[model samples]
Target: MDQISLALLSVFFLLVSIVWYSWIFKNWTKKLPPGPRGVPILGYLPFLSHNLHIQLTDLARKYGPIYKLWLGTKLCVVISSPSLIKEVVRDHDAVFANHDPTVAGLVATGGVDIVNSPYGPHWRNLRKVFVREMLSNKNLDDSGPLRRYEVRRAVRNLYGKIGTNVDVGELIFITEVNVVLCLIWGGALEGENRDKIGARFREKVAKFVELLGKPNLSDFFPILAKFDFQGIEKEMKGVLPSVDEILNSVISDRMKIMEDSGGEFSSANRRKDFVQILLDLMKQNDIVIGGTDTTATIVEWVMAELLQSPHAMQKAQQELTQVVGLNNIVEESHITKLHYLDAVIRETFRLHPPLPLLIPKMPSKSCTIGGYTVPEGSRVLLNVWTNYKDPQVWENPTEFKPERFLNDDDNGKWDYIGNNFHYLPFGSGRRVCPGIPLAERMVTYLVATLLHSFDWKVPEGVKLDMEEKFGIVMKKSTPLLAVPYQRLPSLDMYE
Candidate 1:
């Protein structure tokens, strides 16, 4: 038995050596980063785990912060450290400005839209419309009333559910969905119709985001994409039509309203970017999905973290009570003055980055990062999750401590502009989230209102689950279910 086992072990080592040397020799001239070798047909594909983000971060431990792995035929590189991230997002921004979308992603966006558009004029135009028009300071400020209406509705609705368990994620999802629809097409759909549309959009978005993260054989083995062995593409394509129906209805309604009002309802007369956003269905679709889900997931997470850490929750509530006051409801105007609450939001972002790996970037050309040659079009995953939780970067990295950010505040050093590589919750670069203006006000105000108007309590002594389920957008695996009771001075304030 011993003799046969020894001989087989020797043979296995010999075979692995042959494969490893073959891979090295094939790309010897490029000087690629070192990585594990896999079977001939599926290179490191079978070995990939469900949570790709966590798996890649773990891989960084064995290999350096920046290393490469072959996913079937795709050469995927992962960057974990801040210095390497700085190189990719900052120094070589243009070279890696392009997005490397998955097959499901391509089907979802139709290869057009600001998030997944090719790095060129078309993308620039979309960004221009998005930034200079759709999300301008003036447009966002004017739209404050729209957002306020939806968020306050949620607060009042929760007030009605006093002492009863409520699903926080569902509550926030519906509110954000309605808020985005308001901005997308003001008063276009309302009453039972708006509620019906929101329900459909919520289902479609959950399916789409789930598909976006699923490992497609087509992505790893491009040749298999047409076949769609997993049917991921078909399912993704199926998801879009329902979304299009919703978008189409909104467009048709808005157009009818315009004609009825003698064309006074044009972008020029109102939001100023409706026409541009309407022209591209995918752009509007991305906005709806990205806008609703990211904000809701973040709000749920902040609540979960605060629930578990009573000290942080009490401190945040105390700050909110002092700043926002019991006589008035939480408002966007109160966001800046709630410094401790701001720290709590920053701390939550640090812990639960909305997009764990900010939309994978593909280099426009072969480039060098961390001194290793990253080939053109290779899927380069920026492991920002690792950077956020790195021991060297933060003290007690895994612990939930908001005070860490407040202790060393210096001239906007910890802002979300992605300037601070150590903490880019929304992301950073030429393609930094254009919706920042709206997201900041929405996320902060929602959390502030909930905390200020009512005190949150976890269901019946159950421990709050902080476990995360990773996708392109990371969310709490277990949805937060809690009760809320009035903390304000009067019920009239809610009205």
Candidate 2:
């Protein structure tokens, strides 16, 4: 045969072999979960809505609680049922402990940060640093003055702008960013440079968050990753340098201090800031990203819910008045006593989880969930939003009713700690968000202070809009613009 005929024969044999191989495996391979049919190549990508959580929930109604989809060549399975979620996150936790980092995630974290790192000794070390060394109760308590200072500063700023429109989300984001910066390196920077660094860090971090969540063709199609069809990865790389520059400067300055101080920088004389502790450990990207974005996003969501539901707002205020008293400002010690405020926060999480689909997981090995075999390396999404709003699981799931969580029975049933499968706002299992303790403290304290110090209402002639915009974090589509009035008896409280 001629060369052209030989090439054609080779191609035919390859195709035949692939078909025969697939056929032979089909009989023994476990069945995949049910899902909607899709067009070839593109799969379900075309049908996806910008608000993916809502669209996926709608699909769940048709395909049952557990379903699968193909985004480009990637296989994705979404689980909305509590039982199935428990199986993946609890029963077989080790099997699905690995994360399937997106293109932006890999680029942003360099695949080493706790959020994206695979489950193993490295991840364990990082978690230990975060839990025992950095975010320990002693550490958080030591940083209380810093958190209080930032929150009070924000209150004073808003008090000055009372009766005028204020973007609540922006205000809270700035406050949370400053607070996180303080927690990270409050003792490192001083005076004007502190403000400048906080502002610069905020600007860069915002860009980083946007780039991380923006849809990328590379994420869905691994073959096209190097090409970066959408330029998302390239843009992420551009933003990453600014963030790294800041982290490197902080690390270098701290290391120099340690070196110059010689033996004086021993454990007994160590600083309380997280940056000092993490100077010799891993990079601070995970701490910065997790500490700032998630806390700020949830605070914004809770404020939005409270603004939309006046009764809920009044109830929270009353609780604050009773617990902390109008004469006294909110303190970290008071958070535990404010049960109603805690319930309101829980209700907000139910309605709008910061990560609707908790960081996607990858099966380290083939596993069974809900009796269907989930192939190794397939992307698994835990739809916390859908599960939280399941009508069978919650009464009036769409309604913003904090009272539902007021009862001890309900409080025991749901929490951010990821115990109960039905309500996993902070996620569940081995890879569950390690920032939960810090998140709860920051969110509750901020919300309590905001509500106790001021009364907020939608601007005159304006209506509250709770429409959600989907991204890595769920945000209010229209930034909440509200007018604040001093609720405290004395202006001294603002100071």
lDDT of 1 by residue, 265-330 (tens): 755436433543555544357877888999999999999999889999999999987887778888
Top candidate on lDDT is 1
Runs off by more than 4 Å, candidate 2: 1-29, 190-192, 263-271
Query: Relative to the true structure, how large is the alpha-carbon lDDT of every model?
Result: 0.84, 0.83
Give lDDT: candidate 2, residue 475: 78
Q: How good is model 1 by TM-score?
A: 0.92
Clashes of each: 0, 0
